[model samples]
Target: MTSTVVEQLIVPIRRSVTRVFNYSRNVKGLKTHLEELSDAKTRVLHSVDEARNRSEDIEDDVGKWLASVNVITEEATRVFGDEDKANKRCFMGLFPNVTTRYKVSTKIESIAEEAVKISVRGKFDRVSYRPSRRGIEDRSHKHYEAFESRGPVLDEILEALKDDDVDLVGVYGMPGVGKTTLVKKVAGQVKAGKIFDVVVLAVVSQTPNLRKIQGEIADGPGLKLDAETDSGRADFLYERLKREPKVLVILDDIWERLELDDVGIPSGSDHRGCKILMTSRDRNVLSRGMVTKKVFWLQVLPENEAWNLFKKMAGDVVKYPDLQLVAVEVAKRCAGLPILIVTVARALKDGDLSEWKDALERLKRFDKDEMDSQVYSALELSYDSLKGEEIRSAFLLCQQYRVVER
Candidate 1:
């Protein structure tokens, strides 16, 4: 009977010592486990495929799991660092150490169990996820000088942008007719209203540099392209743009139809919710080259609007009763062109009645081609406002140089 009692006591005591020894070794291995956990987390975060599937739930789960692992690893390191002391503390006078070792082993085992569970939960399948969008830079300041006549055109463009079927819209007009200004107003309104998830504006000058154009467009969304070749950059752009649910791309000063595919812009049936707004000097570029869904032709401002704009630029000069009549004639000479009107009006501003008369005479003297007369005559009026012969001669020399260079 005594032997049976001894055996029962001995078996439990032996098992307890073995558990303590095994747990001590496992605690040492916790550092390795922590390293693995950290590496796994970095892999998941940087993986484009994994990022696509990233969600709030997954982020929270990972965060909590990582925090818990760090805590356990730190505690285990401290405990295992003084293993000899822990072993000594386990013993009591004339009694085998069972309670302390048992407690330590259980705590370590509990942490290890949790670590396993987290590892399993952290494993995720790749899925589509939204790319981080760069904030749209506000351009409302440019719209301050927008012409009054552009109100109707701005409204029409805004309405067309809202239509589900119209993915591409074009604004075409003569140089300095406010094509850029009108589009800027539209872009500002769209941004303020949050009409699209992303809005990008790029200038495609007469000669389109594919890479430069791509860089500008990519800048809007904060996309960095590391591709060496033009086609590679386009490919990168295509992939990035594909992930955006709604985007508006504005191409200003386009001389010809840009190859949508070459630029990495999706158009036609594959456009998704993306919309393209462009401005060009030629209507043919919009209708034939770009094959835009709708084209809005921006005409020169009317006589009344031109006069109002001229007065606005001329300031207090137009308020003078005597100068008012001459100012009206100067504004009319601008021929309803905002650029010409603003230039000529500002030149004659604060000038005496005689200066205004001289400007009118110089404008009438220019009998060049119709377009040349319209543009250069107004410019010449501004040039004639110079105070002295030396200044005027220098100005004319510069003008001559400009013509030669052109």
Candidate 2:
């Protein structure tokens, strides 16, 4: 029985001593494991760079594994500092330092195992995924009215776009005449038909914000503008835009002359594949200021088409004979402008006979003035008809900050 107990204890004590004696081998093994981990890390970093170039986000597990590898490698580096002490002789330089060797060897083996585990975990099926596209989706799904009067102008714009020699196209109309709507329709169609590989829009407004305009256009191509100055940003954008083989840029509500190069847009002359579609309230803004190759004027809806749109927005209430005549009179008061027709029709859609007559009276009072006066008057009547003060306040704010012409 005594010999049996001694044998069992001898096995564990001998195993422990064996690990201390194998210190050199464990250190060498640690070095090999660290080298393998380093190679794996390099491959992962390369994949991360490629994924970023493609505008993709890295996976959480991959990021975590990379972080663990960094930690393990750092720990392994510190382990080497104890090598001399672990190899020192003790007892007057006659014997190995068993205690130090045991501690150092155990640490090396533990770190080596950790490094191996991390390297195996680094293998992944996918490193990243494409992020959601911005700005383009919002413009793609915007609401547009297919007015008959605007069809000819839309077709003309499309035809001009198809012409190889005509690179710059402009659409000009009075405020509230659906200039923005028509141009947006063109953008949607071109995007759907793949007329251009890249389509971007910037609202130039009455007061142009060059940086904001640059950002909007850059967002389309997933470009990050990190330049500190306007000129620097422009130069960067210019190079990026030039890389696109086929591109369309829509500058909306341009009030005066804007320098294309200053805005970082490659002119049609500079990049033959680049095309520009712009809109403004003044014809000269397009013809003289922008020097467009072709310009189309968007007219107000005709009287018959105006009536039909009014009927649709006002709903079944217009079908009643009693209200039909009054509705026709109200629709005519809109002067064939799409915005005014829709706004005024919605304001009085569910009103009684007296309310319709009151709106008609208000509209007539402003009729003695020019067409612009009539538009503002119809807008005023719509404002008064709104139920809540908060809604009216929001409308005023929108009008004050309206970026597009209408």
Candidate 3:
């Protein structure tokens, strides 16, 4: 009975030793598999941004698994070493403690099983990427309506987009002159026309947020990025963008030149199908640093176009016979700037002929700086329409500093 009990106790130990060997072999094989996967070369997965992203994720997972396995391997080695010392002592007539031997074997078994599970989880058979045939959908297209006067400017931009040699196109104009609207229209047209595989539009205001910009660009191609640092994000963006067949990046309202490298945007010359369309109020921002090919200036609407836009916004209020002449004068005072015309017309949309006349007189009081006068007076009228003193005060405070570069 004593011998039988001893044999029974040793059975678990023997089984555990076998499991440890199997675990080691399986882990070694898994490490080899992971190394092969990490080293395998594949075609540029441009069309499917997800595939590239998935590939990176797999690599990261493998790296983490390898690290974990290293720990498990060390534990297994220590457990086996203890078993060897116990056996050697038994051979030297120092009868090894059966309980300690059983514990060491159990520990090795547990660790080996965990390593096997990790190996199984890290297995990847093959990778396939499908290219996207459809262009990116533009959701903000509805917010921007193409102005009649921006037709020529739109044409110029379209021509620039078509030019193979022109990788960077810059559009500049005075604030409230429709720079954002023109670019939005162009982006919509490009997406609808399938000019590029992916079109990303990001607004970089006076205060540029690099992460926000990268997030916007990543959203275009459904790229899931886990980069914590700016440079890491840029590198990830660069790798993903480099694989795309054609990409159009529209950066709107850039106050100053943004470094393309810093943003992870490869130079136009480096990538054939990559193009950048940036809009700014300052021509110097584009010419001096941003634009690479040609800079297109967007001018204010002509008199007829300005009047048409004003009438459209003013609606029936400006249609009254008594207000016709006064409305024309008010529209003319807008000086072809769409923002001023729209603001004044919308503000007076519910006003009577007397209100229209009063607005015209108010506008006439500020004819000192011509264009500046019209813009300020029109904006001032809009400010006056505010319901509260606090709101008016806030508007005045904002007007003290020009946040929007003109």
Candidate 4:
């Protein structure tokens, strides 16, 4: 009986141990599974973060693309529109329809408002882009003076030319104030292309050289003179220049009447029909040329314009975080001479505040009696290099006059 009892106790203990071992194995398996699931979730979170970063990158690329498209569109619009249209918002003025347009009316196509398309055949009166508003409204006069000027000066010249033999229309201004610029722009407007069929641009300077004048006239359309020789070149220029009907001749800078007929410049038409545009500094020179017509004088740039021009010429070196007052004071010293503005700008382009201050002090102490000593002479050296005699004299005369001739 005792042996049987011991056997039962042994059986119960072995079964209990087996059950405990099975339960422990199951618990370990469950813990391992939980750890694996946690690892998988961490990987998913990392992938989600990567996707968000890629999306942001894509958005930035798209924004850049949009900006590029906008720039291209603006450029395209500007290119397609007509620039010569009278109604276009040019900072300067327009030339009146003088003889006939040298080219097809480019400005006509650019008209945004209710405007008319004009040509030589279809009009009783000349075409013009008359101002809707008056007196320098939204116009940048200084910038126009520097690069190009097509304005009221041209309009009067063209009006004078309509008589068919008007000989001279002088556009006189100071050297840096844009007299030559205006005359050149006017020549572009009045010369013949499709409508008028003739355009003549004769650029001369202070002392007229017969050969240069002859060559200039001969180089235009419908004529090519052998300007290599003095006499033959003159004859060729004179004969052809006389033949063109309804012509606009620019004797750009005439210190004197220059005896246009004497130099191979043809003079067949009565003084009523032919038109000449001359620019010079001396009011007496211009008055002698245009005795009957009223004259227009170009002025110095306003204060703001002079400073802006100075800054542009100065370039990246003149930038100072704290020297704006110094800049304004220096700009004031320039008064309104575009040439001086450019000179100062080039001088100070690589300047600091110290350099700016130094320049201002120098100009302040400049000899008021001798403009030539301070500014005009420096500018005149640049003018002296011009091949055109008219340009040189005109530049000198401009230096002589501080105010415009009425």
lDDT, ranked from best to worst: 2, 1, 3, 4
lDDT (Cα, tens digit) per residue for candidate 3, span 1-406: 9999999999977776665445445445544543443333111123124555554233455446556656765666666666554444355666554555556545655665676575565544433433442332345446455666678889999999989988999998877787877787787788778787778878898899999999988877878679899999999999899898888998888888799888888756679899999998788888887755789999978888898889998898777888999999999877677766776677678788778888777667666655466555554543665434543554464353244423
Best model per lDDT: 2
Candidate-wise lDDT, in order: 0.73, 0.83, 0.71, 0.52
Model 3 C-alpha RMSD vs. true structure (Å) is: 11.8
Clash pairs, candidate 1, are: none
Comparison by lDDT, 2 against 4, better one: 2
TM-scores for every predicted model = 0.61, 0.69, 0.62, 0.50
Question: How many clashes (backbone atoms < 3 Å, residues ≥3 apart in a chain or on different chains) does model 2 have?
Answer: 0
Displacement of the residue 313 alpha carbon in candidate 3, Å: 1.3
Worst lDDT window (10 residues) for model 1? 397-406
Writing each residue's lDDT as its tens digit, candidate 4 over 321-383 gives: 577778777766766777667665665665677767766765566465765333433333335
**Candidate 4 local lDDT, residue 44:** 39
- Tell me how far the alpha carbon of residue 399 in candidate 3 is from the true structure, in angstroms, after superposition: 3.3
Error of 3 at 340 (Å): 2.7
Q: Which candidate, 2 or 3, has the higher lDDT?
A: 2
Residue 331 miss distance in model 2 (angstroms): 1.6
lDDT of 2 by residue, 1-406 (tens): 9999999999988977987989999999999988999999999999999999877999999899999999998898898999999999999999899999988988998998888889889999889977756435355536576766678888999889888898899998877677877777787788778888888889999889999999999987778899999999999999999999888899999999999999999976799989999999889989999999899988878889999999998899888888888899889877677776777677677788888888777667654565355555554554666655543653464353234333
